[model samples]
Target: MPREYRMMTEAPPPLEITDLTTTFVSRNRRTEVVRGVSFTVRRGETMMLLGESGSGKSVTARSIMRLYGPSAEIGGSVKLLGRELLDLAEPQLRAIRGAQIALVPQDPTGALDPLRRIGSQLTEVLAAHGVERVRGAARRRAEELLALVGIPDPKRVADSYPHELSGGMRQRAVIAIAVSCDPQVLIADEPTTALDVTVQAQILELIAELQQRLGMAVLMVTHDVGVAAEFGGRVGVMYAGKLVEEGPARQVLSSPRHPYTAGLLDSLPTPGIARGALRSIVGSPPSVGAFPLGCAFAARCPHARRSCGEADPPLVAVGADRVAACPVVNTEAAVA
Candidate 1:
């Protein structure tokens, strides 16, 4: 089992988001990339945000960190360890950013600098938080971080530039930097997306191991249900900037109540299904900021009813620790 599956208690959770929305304003339009997405990650737990491309999963994660700068209009409650983050000033937020919360971005190559050695980058992070002063202490700490993330030759890797390392190694280095300060929460935005299948599994295992050792809450964003299933904790499914279904990973994946979730599961290739005959959800997701008044997935949902187009549905309880946004789920449950 993934390390994040371990049961634990942390009051107020490590991170809590409520009605989080992000909008980008332009001359002619205001695009709401994230719409009232809410979820929580307890200490040592992973909350996987699963969705397709353009579903606004990545935007939601960045919004938590307030990475959009002045171009985005963000509103909602983002609490870290019981303290609100949205209203904090930039200097105050900077203090909390790397020390309490960290981000493991998707492309390690792009994240790392080509000119500077890896050790310098890692030390920079330490210096930013005043974790270690003096060059010697910072270098030693950076080396230790590299070793902690499973770098074979920590000293050697640290001395090399970003382009000197392989894809997996660079990713490991990124993880090391993210954990250097021992943050309370780690937001991994597709940390394994660039690696091969085998490397992807290794990276996931590495993240789980680090989460256990550091005892940090993790918000992992990914499009792959298999990755979420392997991580095995809470699952939140998003579509058209809205959270459509959320519950325990096993329950949601096995007995998904929402039609969109069902479609995602059906799209995965199964043992019985022939190679070319695998099922796929018809129609693409609605464009950003252009979702219909009804359920965003109504156009592609096979079970969509007349009421689906009447108005957007709110997440309603369907089972133990589970909720789905489709009215049909409740109707089906009542009939059953």
Candidate 2:
């Protein structure tokens, strides 16, 4: 187990997002990609936003960092250590971005500048954040970051271009840059998606170690249940931009509440389950531009009722620190 996996309850929440919505406008039409998603990340803890592709996982993350372009219309509140993030000016936002809240994006290859050396890119971030005053100091700090992220021969690797490094090394270098300022919050959007299984484990372990050392809150967005189970303290299941289910990782994995969450767990490959016996969700995720009238997952949910198609269910408390947005749970509890 990585160091970050060691549970600690004394730390305060480093990041909080409340009723956040992100919409994209085009041709006088607007489509919401993130729909009032809210969650918190305590220092030294990892909260995973777990869902399949197009489930608004990445959109929610980008909204936190305010990385969406001009066409994007955002609402709601994001706070880093109780400071409002959405209302900040561009320059202020930039100052806080890498220093307070950093993002390790999904694609490392696309994130780095091909024309620049890795060391220079890392130094630019440090310089921009005012972490290092002199060019020589920035270079030294860059080399230290590379070594901290487990890159071999930090000096040699720092001088190399992004393209010269392997996929895993590039990803590590990106993580190094993201954590250079020792941010209070780290949002990793599918950081291990492009890597092989071995590399994935290594990267996850690295993140866990850094989180523990820095006491930073981590918002890890991933589609893999296994990864969430392994790395997340709390797991949130999103559907059509809404958080459908959330709870302690162990409870959620053992007994998922939402139909969609259950279906996702059922689809995971298990040791005892025969190779051909794997289950899959019945339908594709709904499009953001044209979501259904009621529950976004009602169209595909096996347990959906008449009320499920009428209105979106509110997230109701199911247990201590557990919430699920499903009418079935309420109906079942009422009947029982």
Q: What lDDT is reached at residue 146 by model 2?
A: 97
Off by over 4 Å in 1: 1-10
Q: What lDDT, from 0 to 1, does candidate 2 have?
A: 0.91
lDDT of 2 by residue, 140-247 (tens): 999999999999899998999998999999999999999999999999999998799999999999999999889889999999999999996999999889999998
Q: List the residue pairs that clash in candidate 2.
A: none
- Which structure among the candidates has the greatest lDDT? 1
All models, RMSD in angstroms: 4.2, 4.8
| Cα lDDT, all candidates | 0.93, 0.91
Which residue runs does candidate 2 get wrong by more than 4 Å?
A: 1-12, 333-336
The C-alpha TM-scores of every prediction are 0.96, 0.94
The CA lDDT at 208 in model 2 is: 96
lDDT of 1 by residue, 97-129 (tens): 889999999899999999999999999989999
The Cα RMSD of model 1 versus the native structure comes to 4.2
